[model samples]
Target chain A: MKVMVAGGAGFIGSHLIDALLAQGDDVVCVDNFFIGTRENIAHLHGNPHFKFYEQDLTDLDRMLKIFQAEQVEYVFHLAANSDIQASAQNPMIEYKNTYSTTFILLECMRLCGVKKLFFASTSAVYGEQMGVEVSEDAVALKPISYYGGAKLGSEGIISSFAYMNDMSVLVFRFPNVIGPRLTHGVIFDFVKRLKADPTHLRILGDGTQSKPYIYVMDLVDAIMRFKDVEKGITLYNVGVETQTSVTRIAEIVCEKMGLPEIPFEYTGGRGGWKGDVPVFAYNLDKIHAAGWRASMTSDEAVAKTVEMVL
Target chain B: MKVMVAGGAGFIGSHLIDALLAQGDDVVCVDNFFIGTRENIAHLHGNPHFKFYEQDLTDLDRMLKIFQAEQVEYVFHLAANSDIQASAQNPMIEYKNTYSTTFILLECMRLCGVKKLFFASTSAVYGEQMGVEVSEDAVALKPISYYGGAKLGSEGIISSFAYMNDMSVLVFRFPNVIGPRLTHGVIFDFVKRLKADPTHLRILGDGTQSKPYIYVMDLVDAIMRFKDVEKGITLYNVGVETQTSVTRIAEIVCEKMGLPEIPFEYTGGRGGWKGDVPVFAYNLDKIHAAGWRASMTSDEAVAKTVEMVL
Candidate 1:
């Protein structure tokens, strides 16, 4: 199988690329290096089955050329302006990088006869869930930030194309995915803050805001498992079943770093930033029914992530 | 006041131009005439207060040039590929017209120092509603169609601009607005179909899909009334509070045309084409509290729209 991993140098994408290569699949890693870094994919440089292309997904012609040349079979579209907080500030950048780029990639895939896609969506698409456990089917997707809006927009486009063009799309709404090679995330931010000053870690908003977390490797595994599902537009929540609070994550960071219980300073109240989903957990029964489940809990995932980042 | 009405030659925009001109405001009507007809705004061509410019909003330089030359004070962004069903079939065109154009417009507005804007959003942004009444405060803005997604994308950009810059934005999530000068709606489609074949009318889906309909005049009134609201980013559900079924609308269309009861044919069993929201209704309590409400009932709005189109 020939697989194209868009944003393959980013945190989750790099992990997925490694797994794909291990599974004997030929991989074409494409990245614009906006948020993605070369260091993430540098290990796979000399591999026989792995190839890399530095290109922006927003450029339709460049993407089309790559798609045709590679004869790509499956596309794991993870490239995006993944910062939810920044989207609330520079939304045009988010829309262009995330939504427009996704649209362009889909168009290129359709033109090149690629039929299968693994789209990395987010739980932020559910906005603020009313219930404690959010299901892919139950939650109405009202995204507060531009990032969520772009993901939902990309989902809608993919669904439309799937129905109209006989394309198979598996959309995974991932929770807070944390692990190594991550450029931006709550755990990464906390680690960086702690490294800068050992006294007190400045936490945005109140520390009571809670959310589910999934390890990057676990999310990548779930995505790969669900890629070839025989559904036209199958959507799944890829995350651990349990919820973890922000304060717990902070404490886990301190514990993992072998630092004295660092005093946490809450800058203010509410979520981390504007358009942040403060509290939500996912009902993983849909994906678990498919014989797939996360091995680590949210706290365990956060602790492991802190250990890796620290 | 100098107001720029993008897509001013089309349906609701033409009506808005009239209202603005009647208020002694200079109107710069910008449109590419894709669906907008010159016949719609033909009357105001020679009026000293009204000027027309044919240009695509995606062309940033062209738009900026017009903004600088016209010295526009306020903007009424009505330009978009308005058809939702068509957008599902052709998502890229819709995105380019609706989402990309909005980004360009916002950039141009920022460059020109224009602060006030009245953006025409849609109820489709709500996607499939959980209950009979949907409100602006309700989360889960899952727009099922590319059209809705594009509108939501535009809202995201506008909201971000409002928060980041000193801009006042009023976003009106209009329901099925229909009336005189309306180019497209269920009422207009039904009338056009019945005129071609009065004995047999082809209705999409089961014809039981219900939606709130607002007269164009009422929508314009609501927008004008809320234009000066001091909020940085304000959103309102602008629609006739009563819900009307498509079957009811068909009956009203037949009666208005003085035709025999037409045999309605359901093309398969979908309320609309793929990506169409089968049922939706808005909670107008917020807008009603804002000292404005739709005067016409949904049925009345449908009937009056049929009369006008016929």
Candidate 2:
């Protein structure tokens, strides 16, 4: 199978490329190097099945040209604005990065007769839930952050294309996916902050702001092993079963870094930022029912991620 | 109260202006005059409390300037690309008109310290449903048409802004809103097509596509009498309780227009166009629970609209 992984040089995308190549699928990795880097996918240089294309996904003509020229059969759309904090500063960044990119890709796919799509949606699409865990089919989807709004917007766009254009789509609402080659998020921030000054660590929200975390490998595995049913839109919340807290993560990071009793200064709030959904979690029953479960819990994932980063 | 009604020269917006002016609130009506007409709001020219601004809402700088300078308190965001068929023809039309307009409005409101928003969403957001009446909270929102996708996208953007910016918002998912000053819809199309040829009427779908319709006056009344509860995001699906079919509407139009047993020719297939939902309907229990109900049935609304058009 000839496949394209958009944003394939990024952390999770690069790992996904590895899994796809291992399965004997010829892969094309496209990245604008916004969040993704050449260093992440540099190992695949000598491989014949691996092809690298450096371009922005927002250009419809260029994207369509690539899709037609390559005769791309399947697409794993992993490219998106990874920074949640940055979105509050510029709403258009996410709108362009996530929504417009997805829109262009769907149009390109429709034009090129591509039949399948693997979309990496986020749990932030649920926004700040009243409860801990939110199921896929339950409640009106309300994405609070600018980033989440764009993501949720992209999901709607993708679903529309899937139904109207005769394509099968698998949308995985991922949790805080953390692991090696970490570009951004809580673990990376902690490591970056701690290394600069190990004596005191300042957390974004109140120490009680809790959410679920999934390892990058677990997420990659979930995508690679996704059972493609002959359906329109198949959705799953991909993450660990358990939830984790900010304090637990801070403690884990401090422990891993060999720092004793680091004074944690929290910017007291419900959310880390204006659009952050604290205490975010998703119901994992759908994915588990589909015969895919995370081997590591949220805490264990965080621990491993901390170890990997340190 | 100094209120701003975007797209106030259009069908529902003009009617909403009547209700607002009757309550003695100062209104500034903004319209790009795209689908909106001066003839619609021509009567309000002599009224001292009403002001009409001929401009597009997508202009963020201009919109923020207007909002800030006018000291706009409440906003009725109604400006959008109304034609569903045209959206599939030009996919970006709906996105730019509906989605981009809403995004710019929210940002402008936030900048101008505007606290409340009344967003006009659509049942198209629900997409094609199995059941007759889908609830506001239930059923995962999957908008199929380009217009539906854009409307759904705008709703998410509004919800996000309401939650993130300390603003109160009410999103009313309207069904086929029919009455006087009707710019374009199934009823208008039927009337126009019949006028062009009284011998035969051409229906787009299989003539069995059932959906709900609400009187524009009823919709206006609902918006005017909306109970201002202190909440971040308040949502309600506003429409008639009973369902109306396309065939029934065709019959009603022919009878009302004095056509003698016209042969109805269907274009064939479930959808009239690319994005048309065959059996689209919305549940109005949420709005009724909030102490507002439709005064007319779907059939009555259609009949009255036919008379008004004649």
Candidate 3:
């Protein structure tokens, strides 16, 4: 099948493209490189089955033309401004990159008569559900950050489009995904910070913040596992059931970089920054019932990500 | 107190403005008059307490100037394209009127340091939950129409703004609101159709489509009752618990028009239009528990609206 990945030059998207190509599927990759980087997709320079477009998904006319030209059957919408702290300063980043992008993509799909879609939503949509293991069907979705709000808004838009246009949509609410080619997160930030200063490390918040972290391959596997399900609108929470703490991640990074004796300077707070939910968990009963689970735990994922990035 | 009522020249908005003025509050009304009319607020021409701006809410620059100039203490955001069928035909109408307008208004409020807000949401956000009375805290919000989707998106935006800016927001998910200045709905359409041809009345759907109809004044009363609740984010279903059928509404309109023997021509379908949820109900338990309730029933509101319009 011919597929289009909206953020195909980014970390997760690049890996997804590699998997799609290995499976002998023609992949049309589109990205504006706002959060995505060309280096991620540099390996696929001249692959016959891969096509690349340096285009903004929010531009409906151009996207429509690509859909018409490519005759793309499926869409994996992963393009978004993933930086939560930056969006806290200016909410328009989330509005444009996350919310409006989804609207424009859905409109393009509707106009082009494309029906199949896989949207990359976030667990941030659950907001500060600290102790509760939030399910796909959790009663209230009150997002704290602009990014989370935009993702939630995008999901609402996708749901309406699915019902109105008879489209089959699969939405995955992902937790912290970590692996090779990781662009940005705690692990990446820790590694970068440690390299800048070997003896002292600055931590944003109290080191007690913990959450699940799934490997990128595990997430890609989960997507491929249930991509064929032709449901009107099916949502799943994708993540490892286990969690790893920020301090634990710091230890893993220090050990990997041969700097285990580095002192950890803490910025005491419940959250790392404004609009941060310190901790949350996903209830994976629905996805587990569907016969797909992550092969690595959060700690293992974090450790491996440290090893690869270092 | 000084308050800004967006879309203040429209049906429900005009009534809200009147109530605000009666309560001795200075009112700043803004409307582009797309769905609103000049006649709705023509009587307030000489009232010093009332100020009007022929402005579009989506223009952030102009709205910022309006907010700064008005020094608005509170905002009652009733601006949206309420026409569901029209939005179904063109989804951008909802995206622009409902979703983008809310984002701009919230941004304006943030910039101007105006905290309190009252938003007019819709039960369509609950989607097609047949026979189930959906509460504000319903587990899954899967809107079926473009209008509902956009409204739901707006709610998500509002939630984020409330959290990040420490603002208080009151979101009221309104059902079918009918009253004297009503511009559209089944009752209004039925009256218009009967007037166009007294011998033949064309009713959309099977005419068995039943839902709650809250009178404009009753809805306004509910808003005024809970507007001062300075909660971070409080959502309420503002509607009468009782419901009325479309056929019953047609009968009521005919009787009110003194043409009770008019033939009712039914366009048979589950929903009146493509994106219509044939039947649903609002769970008002939360609002009722909060010591507030609608003074009118759905049937009574419908009957009264018919009598007044005729």
Q: Which candidate comes out best when scored by lDDT?
A: 3
Supply DockQ values for each candidate.
0.22, 0.63, 0.80
Best candidate (score: TM-score): 3
Which order, best to worst by TM-score?
3, 2, 1
- For all predictions, the C-alpha RMSD in Å is 4.8, 2.3, 1.4
Best model number under DockQ = 3
TM-score result, candidate 2: 0.94
TM-score for chain A in each prediction: 0.96, 0.97, 0.98
Clashes of 2: 0
Task: Calculate each model's fnat, 2 decimals.
Answer: 0.15, 0.64, 0.68
Task: Please give the distance, in angstroms, between residue B252's alpha carbon in candidate 1 and its true position after superposition.
Answer: 6.9
For model 2, the TM-score of its B chain against the native B chain is 0.96
- Candidate 1 chain B weakest ten by summed lDDT: B156-165
lDDT of 1 by residue, A164-248 (tens): 5677888898878887787777888888888898899999888988888888888878876777866477888888878788888
Off by over 4 Å in 3: none
For all predictions in the order shown, the interface RMSD in Å is 4.3, 1.3, 0.7
lDDT of 2 by residue, A1-310 (tens): 9999998998889999999999999999889999999999989998999999999999988988889789878999999998888878777677778777888888888778898999999888888778757889868888888878888888887777887788889899997888888877888889899999888999988989888888889898888788375658999988987878998899999999899687999889887878877777678898888788998899999999899888
Q: What TM-score would chain B receive for each of the candidates shown?
A: 0.95, 0.96, 0.97
Docking class of 1: incorrect
* Candidate 2: C-alpha lDDT: 0.86
